[model samples]
Target: MRTSFIKKKKNASTDVALQITSMADIFMILLVFLLKNYATSVTNIAPTAHLSLPEVNKSKGVIKETLKVEIANDLVMIDQKPALALHAFQFDPSEDGPGGVSPTVARVLNEQRKLRPEPNMDSSLLVMADQQTPYSTIKRVVASAASAGFVDLQLVVVQGE
Candidate 1:
């Protein structure tokens, strides 16, 4: 009788060896549900302290799929990295002894272009400028981007709160 009881216990333990297929099924269902509800078409790029975009009423939504250059009052940033510092809204590129286009900006733009497949300077650029930024300063940044071959520039602005 004892031997029969031991045999029954062993059989029960074997039957209880964790049912993993059910757990796997649950995970698969959850993954499918999440994928179906995921939002993939829109890309959102938020502004930072160094780049405070002006508020505009009739502008389109933000485009974050392309390369970005941010021009601040005292700094220029590309890809969120500080590419150069300005002295009173002026930067002398170390590459070209003082007084041409901001060399640092030009060089960084060229480098950024290399990441694209097109050999020509045809990368789309987004310029995020502050409200207090001067028009002349904005022109210099646009010119530098154009020289680097990025003609498709979309100015970044915020919606009125």
Candidate 2:
């Protein structure tokens, strides 16, 4: 009887082992997928020496997709690319088109508008101008942007404590 019981136990086949290697492979693939798709939410704001932004007590946070225009002492940049150059912080009258709009600025802004997801809905620009920049130059830039279908404008300034 004892020999029969041992044979029955041997035939039961109770030596099953869990397959962990496949599970581990699945977890590694998931980790890699997550890492590949991860995107940072932080926005970067860089300050340059050529532009001196005015100080304000309160200001709103900048949107990541907003078009940025920087006016320095000697140059005007769109999205950090030089769009126009100024002589002694002044623009030439010939640079202005009909209705006092800058043709260079208008062309660039139009190109940017087409790249937007909703161009009409995002008709806004963030302008950072030097403190010493003349108001006339700023106005011309604004006019050019407006002509390119960007009507909502926000001036970027240094946030004060």
Candidate 3:
């Protein structure tokens, strides 16, 4: 059986209108509700390959722009660029920072500070280290960055399970 709504008329066609006013209203309400409850501030930066951050429930703002330093077990990367490769715990003395610090990282930092002199950005350097990375290595990297004028450094970590 066919519905009469599909019938074609030579003169005025049958007036078959869909009553979507309520659906439109519902959709509008839903859009408004979702927009009203949307979070514009809190941002979550996901960890990349060869990097795993510790999960912790903490209220921290997202970094819009900053110099990133990633310290993995086998390599150290600055701003996603591999700065130095590590073999075991002992890094190449000529390639890394100074005493008890990352030499190559320190060199790279120094070069970056010399090349791009962003006084404000120099402070906000974020370090994303692996979970298995030792605390001492983290401290050394922090110290290296500090020596390179990066005082406001943040250690990024995962938020939850």
Clashes of each: 1, 0, 7
Cα displacement (Å) at residue 133, model 3: 0.7
Give per-residue lDDT, candidate 2, residue 83.
83
lDDT to native, each model: 0.73, 0.81, 0.72
Give the per-residue lDDT digits (tens) of candidate 1, residues 8-88: 443444455789999999999999887776655333455544656788887777575677788787788887778887765
Error of 2 at 139 (Å): 0.6
lDDT of 3 by residue, 1-161 (tens): 76788667679768899999999999999998877766553233444448677777773755655677888878888876888786543366664445566666777988777666565455668778887887777777888888788888677766663
- Would you list the clashing residue pairs of candidate 1? 121-149
C-alpha positional error of residue 99 in candidate 2 after TM-score superposition, expressed in Å:
1.2
Worst 10 residues of 3 by lDDT: 40-49
Error of 3 at 72 (Å): 0.9
lDDT of 1: 0.73
Q: Could you tell which candidate, 2 or 3, scores higher by lDDT?
A: 2
* Candidate 1 TM-score, C-alpha based: 0.63
lDDT by residue for model 2 (1-161), tens = 44654444446777889999999999999988877766443244454438778988877766455888888888888877888888877887779698889898899989988988897788888887888888888888989999999888778777798
Off by over 4 Å in 2: 1-43, 60-64
**Top candidate (TM-score):** 2
Ranked by TM-score, the better of candidates 2 and 3 is: 2
